[model samples]
Each structure stands twice: as C-alpha cells, then as structure tokens.
Target: MASTTDTKNYKFNHSMIRVKDPKASIKFYEHLGMSLLKKLPFPDAKFDLYFLGYDAPQSVSHGKEIWDREGLVELTHNYGSEADPNYKVNNGNRDPDRGFGHTCISVDNLQAACQRIEDAGYKFQKKLSDGRMKQIAFVLDPDEYWVEVIGQKSVEETEGVTTTDPATYRMNHTMIRVKDAEKSLKFYQEVMGMSLYRTNENEKAGFNLYFLGYPGEKGVPQGYQADREGILELTWNYGTEKDEKFSYYDGNSKDSEGRQGFGHICISVDNIEAACKRFEESGVTWKKKLTDGRMKNIAFVLDPDGYWIEVVQNERFSGKPNF
Candidate 1:
C-alpha cells in the first residue's frame, strides 16, 4: 500500500510517444475526436511537442490551448524522422522488444466508433469479431501504434449494430507492457500510491490487464473505473519472467541502432522535492534527478522493468484540478 502522504500528493498527468510524421499523427488523433490542444516547438532541439485532448464544451473556445490537462496525449515529433534517412523512430511494430503498448479511448458507442474508424480507411489490428473478448477492439494509427477502443455500455448493449456519437469519446488510459506483474503492481501501489481499480485476466491469451489510479475523496470515485480519465493500464504477459531472453523494449531507451519511441509517463507531485526524497529513501532508482538536469524542478524514476516515470511539481502545471 502507498503511504498516506504519497497518496495525497500524486496525480497521473500524461504519457508521451514519439512520432515520425506530425501531420499524419495529429490527423489520426483528431479523427478519434481529440483536439490538438497545444504545440510546443523546440527549434533548437529539432523537435516539437503536440498535446491532444478531448475538450469539454467550456474549454473548446481556448482554440489549441489546453486548460484541462487531464488525459492528454503528448506526441513528440522529431523534425527529421520522416525526411532524413539517418533518423529512426520506433513505431513499436519492429518487434516485441518495443515495450510500449497501446493507449485507450472510451466511447459512448463502441460499434459506431469502430465503424467510423473503418469508414475513414483506418485498419483494425483486432476487430470486434476477431477477439474472444469482444468488449474492446484495437485500431492502428498512421504510426502503427495500437489504440484500444472501449465502449461506455456493457458488451450486451453493444452486441448488435450501434451508432457512435464522436462527441462522447474521450481519452481514457495508456497501457504499457510489464515483465513482472507483481513487481510493477507493487511499484504503482506503494511508490506511486495508486489504487488498483480493476484487473482482467485471460488464461487463453496468456496475459493480464491491471488498471491502476488514484481513488477516494482526493481522487477518482471508486466506481468510475470505466469512465475515469487518465488511468494507467499495466499489461503483464505470462512466462516472460521465466524466459531470460524475453525482454520488452523500453521505448525511451536506445538500442544499437539509436531508435526511440514511447517516452515516460508524467506524475504531478504536490511537493516534488519531498517526493524525490521519499522515493530515494524507498530505494527507487533515479533515472534523472532534479539536481542532474537543467530542469531542476523535475525528476525521473525507473520502474522494475526500466520504464521511466517523470515526477514534476504540480504548481508548475496549474490550470485545472489535479488527477
């Protein structure tokens, strides 16, 4: 269990992924009803950060400015990745080594959403009829990154043909592949102070899905598992632990070829300095400490499987309520 102090201070903010073509990537997300909230360009760095989210009616007038940062997907585009032959970015399709999994979007009508995607000429990695678990489906974006589509209603409600209201769709969760379920679960629960909201096991598929989020008075309501925004889904595939050769690629790290893809997940802390001290005392490995980088207010910690968790001060990201 996470300590009360840690529980009170943490909020899951966003997950980032690298994209080769900003135009295509942005188009794909927009098709799913996510508006391009903001774009932060770093000409010196030769990259740009594009933040996309589902804008509520109140914030729609901001026009590319994201007042509510919850459930935002940060798309990092390296300027030369698409044009320069020497540049490489991981789309996660090269191999199982690409550890980053799919991000999810919840829709009021799953059938209609899937149809819209198909009508728009996007391919489905897993169709509604293609899987034993028909409640969810997977669609591939232009980058070939998987995007899971979940419905608001039960499987029974969506058994037949349905109509989709794109306006009701919103970014829900980001999934990451984990090697050891127990170890990752402990890290999220104890270190990050997130509650295990839900779990789904597929014996036939040889995998398990564990959803974790901050819950209670200061967090999301316990019953809001399906409708919650910005949840983290950890996927643990069985037998990966026993096989020493089996290792999922950390999208943030470089292989011999210098390819990178998915970046770290950000967690806003009420007191970043104090949180870092607690993490260090708990024996958590630091990837980039506040003192190490120029950005002294932010820090990064590594999970058991080497996935980076970025910790930033909540005050620095003021706008809407924290998760």
Candidate 2:
C-alpha cells in the first residue's frame, strides 16, 4: 500500500504503436488533424519516437512539453521496420489474437470526418451506415490498424444524418484486449488507482467492454463515458479464461520475428520515486525500473496480462508550470 504522501494522481499521457512507415503513418494522422508535436530519436537504441496531438494553436509552442496534452499518439519506428521488406507490424486486424485493439478519435461531426477520410482515398472497416451502430465507424490506417471514429452527440441524435463541424476533433481512448477481465480489472483498479467509469456487457455478442478512467475526487457522473476523455477501454472476450494457454499478443513482446505492433500506454505521475516504491511494495511486475535504464526518471510496469504501462514523472515530460 502506498503511503499518504506517495498517493499521487496519475494522468494518461499517450499510447504508442509501432509503425512500418513513419512517413505514411504521420500522413494518415495528419489527415485527421493531428499535428506532429515532437520527434525524439534514440540512435543508440535504434528507434525513434514521434508524438502527435490533436489541438494546438500557432501561438502554442510544443516540443517535449506537449506531454501535457491528453490523448497524444506516440508512433514508434524501429531502425529498419520500414527498410526491411519482410518486416510487419501487427495491426491486430490480421491476427485477432493480438492484444492491442483500436484507438478512438472523437469528432464534432462523425459523418463529415468520415467523408473527409473517404475523400482522401482511405477505406473504412465499418462505415456509419454499414452497421447497426450508426454513430460509430471504423477507419483503417496505412498499417491496417483500426481507428474508431465517434461523433460528439449521442447515438439517437446522429440518426441517419450527416453532421459537419470542422473545429472539434480530439484523441479519445485506446482499447486493449484482455484475457482475464477480473485479473486485469484488479491490477488496474488496485495497482493503478483507476476507477471503473462504465461497463457494457453484450451477451449476444459474447463480450464485455469495460472503460476505466482516473477520475479524482470529482467522480464521473452517470452516462458520461462517451464524452469522458483519456479513458482506457478493456475488451474481454467472454470465455478466454477457460483456456490456460490463451493469451493475447502484446505488441512489445518479441520472438525473433521482430517487435510487435502496439507499444505501450504511458501514465504521468506526480513523483517517480514514490510511484516506483509503491509499485514495488504492491509486487507489480517491472519491465524497466527507474534504476535499470539510462532514463532514470521513467519506469515501465507490466499489467497482469503482460501489457506494458509506462510510468513517468509529470515534470520530466511536460515540465513544471510557471506560477
């Protein structure tokens, strides 16, 4: 258990995904109004990290400081993933067993955004009119990664009509598939101090969707999951727990084939030392502890199902605010 001083709040920073072609991936997100906030290259590590965000005025100067922006996408490009013709980034579409799911972007006008995406010569996995869920659609990126498109309004309001608004667009949430819903839920709730904001269990569909968020004292009000930002969606297939060997492919894992697709989810904490101490006391699995890496301020903790969760000091990325 964390001491009173060690109990600090956490904010979702970014979700990373491995990209085959940086140019194409960046273009795809740019088409959706995400600007490249910063690009950090680790020559020794043989990889580069590109951070992209939704909203930024010209007056706002962004670099590493843009970490303060919620819902940012970090595209990780290995040294030769693009140059090697045989290398492939698992987008989860081809392999249903992959752990990473789709990342969502909320737009003021779902129809207009879909049209824009279509006009840009992109194809949709599920169009607005194609499914019973009219308000939501799925667009595929260059790597065949699913990007869920959601409208700002409720499903009832988006009935059969195209809404258009250019100004409203932002990163929403990243969904991940979990083998054991109960175990994963316990890790997130007990270890990370997150709250279960919403849950949707579809018996007919044979699955359950759980949305978790770090809502502080001001808890989430009823029926606000759709609008709530920076939430993580855990998709649990009803009977995966029955099979002892059943497990989803974590993008960060490697087995001579190369690194998997999706990278990790990052959370910013108030104090890195305290957080690390707490995690140690809780017996959470550590991928990269603060003392293990050159970047001493950042650490990576693995959830129950082996998904990497990055924990970092808030000030290290965003910097301390000026009083």
Candidate 3:
C-alpha cells in the first residue's frame, strides 16, 4: 500500500497565460522575488518573451540541473492583430476580468509579501493568505490577469520540514474558469474538502474569481516546505454559455477537445492504491487507471466539471517520506 506521498512522479512545469503587456507583467513577478532569467525576442514574430525563477546559478560539475534549479514562471507578450477566438474585439466591450486565470507564489513572510506587493503600487484583489494562517495576496498585471503570492516559510516553518533545492520549484495552486463561481466553489469545498481561501464578485471587472486549496496542509508538497512560489489559476467568464469546445492558446479559451484549454492537473501520493481508494470512497471517478502501459503505475480522474486530473504513485523519487 502506497501513501499519498509515495508517488514521486508528480511535477508542475508552469502555468502559461497570455498577456497584452509583457514588461509590466515581468515587473509584477520581480516584485515577488523572481529574477529575470532568459528573455527571447522574436524579431520575426513581434513578440517579447521572458522567463523568471528563484534559483541560484547552475553548477559547473553538473551538466544541467535536473530537480534542483529555481522554480520558474514564463511570460510572453504578443504584439500583433491577434483576436481571442472566444472574445470579440469591440471598443464598447470592457476588458476581461482579473480572474480569467492567475498564478500564485510562495514567499518568506505572508504579511511582508502582501506589503511588498502593495508597496509596488499595485492594486490587490484579495487579502493576504490568512484564512489558513498563510500569507497569500492577489494582484493583477497590466493585462488584468491575477497573480498570487504565499509565504514560503509557512510550509518550511511547519512542525518539521526544510525545503531546500535549486530544482525544487514550488509549483502549487491551479485556478480555472467555470460556468458558475458559486457552483465551482461548492464543488471543491464540499466535495473535495478544500477550504475556500477567498473569492470575489468583481462585476465592475466583468468576471468573478475564487481560490481554493487543501484547507489545513502545512504546505503543498514538492519543495520549499510551504514558502514556495506559484499557484494554479482558474478563469470563468460570467453569464457566458459553456462552449462545446474552447480554444487553448493560453489566452481566453477552454476548449476541452482542442489542444488549448486547461489541461489535466496532477497530484502525487505515497501509496497509489490508498489514494485511489480514498477518491473512490469519496465518490470521485477515474478516467484512466494504473495498468500495464506506456506510463505504468499512473491513473487519471475527473472532477465533476469534466476537467481531468492525474493521480499517481510516483516511483522515481521513492526515497523521500512524502515525495
């Protein structure tokens, strides 16, 4: 029997979002402690790209850092006559809401993190992470997309834990658009047992937002204890019909069938059998189950909303207690 922490195959790369202003967005993350990594300018493409992370320089002895570099968040600014497939470009129409999709980061101090962000002259949409005794703040880039920050030390400060690793990128949190924020909130909180950290009905902004997570976990798993960087972002357009299929350009689309949209999310567990059993006991259904196949010992499950999620007993990092 494997425990939830036994699955070590779980990993989150980065959540990609479309931004109208790249430089401003870059400054937003920089304010949260992320450094500018590599910036790629597509001269032929009229788009500027930037990558930011909180890791030290690479070592000479090791070829390339595997699971030991700083966590990273990528931002791309596209300049052109591009149109959001789902949204019509009308001058009369207002801008999309700030919650369309957002990213969250872990910081050293919850209050300090929020203060720092507020000090930067940015408008915060949500309070610091306090509901769960963690510092979490929500602010938006110039494009109106929200980015959250959580105190990294909280997880590390837990009873006993130390998050140290260059590759240990704390990739936590995932938010997506739903037909009804209330319904989605209830689904996660009531069904999944996640505590509703915070939510907003920003009619003035043309949308609503909600953030939920495991209510009492000292910190999310992977690295840095609790004081890590990043969160999952979700965006749901208000008073809009659920599209049969949406787009997945990291812009404004959630096409389930198309290549674009919120892809499946993964959760690592120590014991795949027990984790799957817990979900089954809780009434969650499986989309794919572990079996003899290409990715052995892996299974997929779906939330009530039809979004896919992966549950696995990561066999790679089998040495750690909650890896």
Candidate 4:
C-alpha cells in the first residue's frame, strides 16, 4: 500500500505493447497527429521503444520528452517480428484470453477522422456505424491493436460547454478488462492513488466502465474521461467474479500462446526502492521485484486482475530537470 504521501510524485507514464512493424505502427499514429517524441533504439538487443504523444495547448514543435509528459504510448518493436510471417500477436479483445483492451485517441470530428482513415485503407475493428456506440469507433493499427477514435466535440456538447478552438487528436485513455471491478478499483484507488473520474453502466449490456486517472499538473479534471490524459479505464462484465472458470490472460505470462503484445502500464515514481518496499509490505502480488531477475531498478507489481504495473523512478526524482 503506497501511503498518501508516497503518491506525491507518482504519475502514470505510458502503456507499452509489442509491435510487429515499427514503420507501419508509427505511420498509423502519425496519421492521428501523435508526434514521435522519442525513439530509443537498443542495437545490441535488436529492439526499440518509440514514445508517441501530443503537444496539446503548445506549438507543434514543443520540446517535451516522454518523462516530462503524460499519456504516451510506448510501442516496443523486437527485431524480426515483422519479417516472421508465422508470428501472430493476440489482439486481447476476443473471448477466453483477454486483458489489455485498447488505447483511445480522442478526435474533434469523428466522422471526418473515420472517413480519412478509410480513405487511407486502414481497417477498423468497429466502425462508428457498425455498433450501438456511434459516438466512438475502433480502428486497427498495423499490428491489429485497436486505437479507439472518439469525439472531443461529443464531450463538449455533453458538458454543454461550447468551445470554438480546434479540440481533437489527443490520447484520451487506455482500457483494460478486469474480472472483479471492486477488487481492481481498490487496487487502483487506495493502493495506486488514482481518482475515479467517472463511471457508466450499461445494464442492458451487463457491464460497467470505470475511469481513473493519476493527478497531472492540472489534476484529474471534473470532466469526462475523453477530456483527460493519462486515464486508465477498467471494464468489468457483470457476473464474472462469481464464475469460477473465468480468467483473463494478462499478456505477460510465458505459457500463454501468442506474441506478448500488451506489455505493461508504467508508473513513474520518486523513489522506486521505497515504493516497491511498500508494495511488498502490503502483501501485493509481485510480477517482478526491484531486486529480482537480471533487471535492477525496473520493477513490476501485479494488480488484482493479474495485470502488471511497471515501476520506475522518474528523471525528475533522479536529479535531472524537465524544464
């Protein structure tokens, strides 16, 4: 359990996923107007990490690195995954095996964006016209990962706040399915220090969506999840908790058959050692300890639903200044 004071410097940094082709994936997000802020290539390891996000409210050429910002999508590309035709990454949205849901990119005009994407020959998992949720659409990236396209104007209209400025193309939130909503909520709220932004129930569909966000410089806004960055959306299907046979493959287990697509969500902290120590004392399940395996400083703690939360000390806490 992280004490209230322990959360002062904690920030939800990024959600990572393995990509088959970096070029295609980067182009996909680039089309959505997300700038490739940084690309860290590990030549010896034959892998790379591409951080993508928006420079909202600032000029397009604003100089903010990944750590200095929030709501980043870390696309990890392992060499040769693109070349191997036999390699197929699981989409995690299907039945039986499911966990990490999708990363949403909120746009201003849903119709225009979907048409533009269609014009580019991109595939959509769920088109705006294909589902009951007409306000949103799910288009697939090169690797088949869903990039949910929602409307910022929809939010503004719902909130009854008219804005004339261009309001679109921002990373809204990342979604992951959980078995037990209450258990996951406790882990994220009490243990993780995230505020419940909102909750919506589809009683007919038999599920509920919970939006939680760690307070950024502006703090969690008193608005819709679509209006905020670095938000984590947890989806719970009704009656899954009582079903003893129910389970979700968290995308990290080795025995799971398929490419480990959805890696983990990272949390930047002030002191990793102290944070992990508290997690240890709280009887939290450990995926990787700070002192475990061959990796040091990089730690992963498990939530109730078996999703991994990677922990790392932020650069600001390590004596480097962002500004």
TM-score of candidate 2 on Cα atoms, chains taken together: 0.88
RMSD of 3: 10.7
lDDT tens string, model 1, 137-231?
99988777889999878768776756777667767889888888998999999988888888889898899999987653446555546566768
Checking candidate 2 for backbone clashes, the offending pairs are: none
**Cα deviation of 322, candidate 4, in Å:** 12
Q: By the lDDT metric, which is better: model 3 or model 4?
A: 4
Whole-structure CA lDDT of model 4: 0.78
Candidate 3 error regions (>4 Å): 1-10, 56-71, 80-100, 129-135, 153-171, 177-225, 228-250, 253-323
Q: Candidate 2: where is the Cα deviation over 4 Å? A: 1-8, 57-64, 155-166, 216-218, 255-259, 316-323
| Candidate 4 RMSD to the real structure | 3.9
In angstroms, how far off is 52's CA in candidate 4? 1.3
Give the distance in Å from residue 1's predicted Cα in candidate 3 to where it truly belongs: 31
After aligning candidate 2 to the native by TM-score, how far in Å is the CA of 310 from where it should be?
Answer: 0.7
Per-residue accuracy of model 4 over 1-323 as CA lDDT, tens digit each: 23323675677888998888899999988887777888888889899989888865552224654674568889998899889987767677766578889999876666777777888899999997886777888999988888898886664353433332222466878899999999999999888878888898999989999998777666666765555677899999999999988888787664256457788998887777787777777789888887788668688988988888988777666666322
| TM-scores, all models, native as reference | 0.86, 0.88, 0.46, 0.89
lDDT: worst 10-residue window of model 3: 88-97
Per-residue C-alpha lDDT of model 3 across residues 1-323, encoded as one tens digit per residue: 43553222233333444454566667776656556666767777687756666653432112222222223455656675244443321110123322235555555445555665676788876765436534456776555555665555553453233323323224445565565556566655554444555555677768766555442233433433344322334455666535544322323333333223223444545466766766677677667766646555667766655656556443434543322
Among all windows of ten consecutive residues in candidate 1, which has the lowest summed lDDT? Answer: 59-68
Q: List the residue pairs that clash in candidate 1.
A: 37-64, 97-249
Displacement of residue 114 (Cα, Å) in model 3 is 1.5
Tens digits of lDDT, candidate 2, 1-323: 22332333677778999898999999999888788878989899999989887654521123435544457899998888788888877775455457888999887667777988998999899998896888789999888889999977766665556655433576778999999999999988888877888899999999999998777445663775545456799999999988898888878667335547888999877666777888899999999999995787679999988889988766643356311
